[model samples]
Target chain A: SQTIHQWPATLVQPVGSPLSLECTVEGTSNPNLYWYRQAAGRGLQLLFYSVGIGQISSEVPQNLSASRPQDRQFILSSKKLLLSDSGFYLCAWTRQGGDGYTFGSGTRLTVV
Target chain B: QQQVKQSPQSLIVQKGGISIINCAYENTAFDYFPWYQQFPGKGPALLIAIRPDVSEKKEGRFTISFNKSAKQFSLHIMDSQPGDSATYFCAASPPNNNDMRFGAGTRLTVKP
Candidate 1:
């Protein structure tokens, strides 16, 4: 069975501070990984997705970026945090040409 | 058309009742429909899914009804319980595409 791990279940960051959230999947190789952000009223929105190492696609341009350093490791980072950047961040993985996705526990970041 | 429209931003239901959420899409290329459930401060998980080849698919108390011609699909939760109270999202994906489009999400509350 595959499992995903996300660090810092909850985070509080000052505006203009740097942000880094890491997610890694176990038991899968070269899986399709995605980063999503869920707002209070808005549903989950795709922020970024990576098909392979060094390949990332941004669904919506904002103060965020994603990188797949290793086949199973994905990281979401921001040069500086913004008040609007606060939300529930999630990491998900699915097999290529697969049916469903498996998501991590998620991290709740609050920008104060 | 890459958008998915969902209805009933929020719902309130009594325990033991049935809960239904609907979604529609304009992309005929989307053949895979999935539903996800998310609890407060948690990541969304796949609840149920179906393909256009089938009109309906059920897993335990959850069911997904897909209307291929209408380009619509819905999620049904039978015997709703307080534990089932969460936000539900409908998503559609094209077989050849790597990205999936998610609905706005419906917040369901089951009063116990």
Candidate 2:
């Protein structure tokens, strides 16, 4: 079975600090990866998605960026975080032409 | 343009009742419809999905009803329980699309 891992499970960052969240999927190759953020009591907002290594599409332009370093490794980063950046970030993967997606545990970011 | 539109931003139901969430899509090319469930501080998980070829699909207490001609779909949760209190999202995607568009989401609270 495939498993997705994301870390750190929870994060507290100061305003203007750098941010890095990593996601890795085991037992799958060349999977579509996505980054999403959910505000408190709100639905998910798609940030970015990648089809292959070094290929990323931004759904919404913001301070955050995503990268696919390897076939199974994806990273979300920001040079300087903003208060608005605080939310629950999720990383998900799906096989090409697959029915549904598998999501990681998620990273709760609190920017103070 | 936002391809998917969901209704009833929030809903409250009594235990053992039924919970229904509706969604409509503008894109006729969308051939896949999926419903995702998310708990507080957690990532969304795939609950159920349906292809345009099917009118309805059921899994345990969850069901997905798709209307291909109307470009609409809905999720029905039977015998609602407090454990089912969470946010539910509706999503649509074409067969060849790499990205899936998600609905605004509906927060469902089943009170015991």
Candidate 3:
């Protein structure tokens, strides 16, 4: 079975602080990874996606970036956090040519 | 612009009733439509999916109705239960497209 892990479950950080959220998948290799952000009571916004190691595609221009350091390890980072950057961050993966994605538990980030 | 649009941002349903959520897309190239369910503080999970080739697909209590000519699809939950209360999202994607476009979510509350 394939599973995704994301941490920390919740985060509270001050404005302008650096941020790092990590996600990893087990039981699969060369799967496509994606990052999505959902504001409270709002729609999900695509952040980034990677097809392979060292390859990332950003969907929107924002104060964040994503990296695929290893085949199953993805990281979301920001040099400086803003109040608007707080949201629920999710990591998902899909097999090549698969029908749907499997998502992680998600991280609730609060930029205070 | 959002590629997929979903309606009824919030819904209240009585247990044993039916819950319906609709979604529309403008992209004619989209070949896949999927619905996701998310509990509070958790990431979304793939609940059901339908391909453009099918008009309706049912899995247990869940059903997806796709109207290819109308460019719309809907999810129906029969005998809605309290455990089914959660947020639902609709998404669409074209063939070979690595990115999936999600609609604004609908929050469903089934009162027992």
Q: Who wins the lDDT comparison?
A: 3
> How large is the interface RMSD of candidate 3?
0.9
Fraction of the native A-B contacts that model 1 recovers:
0.76
Residue-by-residue lDDT tens digits, candidate 3, B1-112: 7889999899999999999999999999889899999999999999999999889999999999999999999999999999999999999988865868999999999999
Q: Model 3, range A15-98, lDDT digits (tens) per residue?
A: 999999999999999999999999999988999999999999999999999999999999999999999999999999998888
- For each prediction in turn, the share of the native Cα contacts (below 8 Å between chains A and B) that it retains comes to 0.76, 0.76, 0.76
Q: Write the per-residue lDDT of candidate 1 for residues B41-60, one digit (tens) a residue.
A: 88888988898999999999
Give candidate 1's whole-model lDDT. Answer: 0.90
* Model 2 chain A poorest 10 in a row by lDDT: A94-103
| Candidate lDDT (C-alpha), each | 0.90, 0.92, 0.95
Itemize residue pairs with steric clashes in candidate 1.
Answer: none
Query: What is the C-alpha DockQ of each candidate?
Result: 0.77, 0.75, 0.82
DockQ winner, 1 or 2: 1
Cα deviation at B4, candidate 2, in Å, is 1.0
Report the alpha-carbon TM-score of model 2 versus the true structure.
0.97
lDDT string, candidate 1, A1-112, tens digits = 8999998899999999999999999998889999999887678789999888999999998999898899999999999999999999999999888877788999999999
Residue B53 miss distance in model 3 (angstroms):
1.1
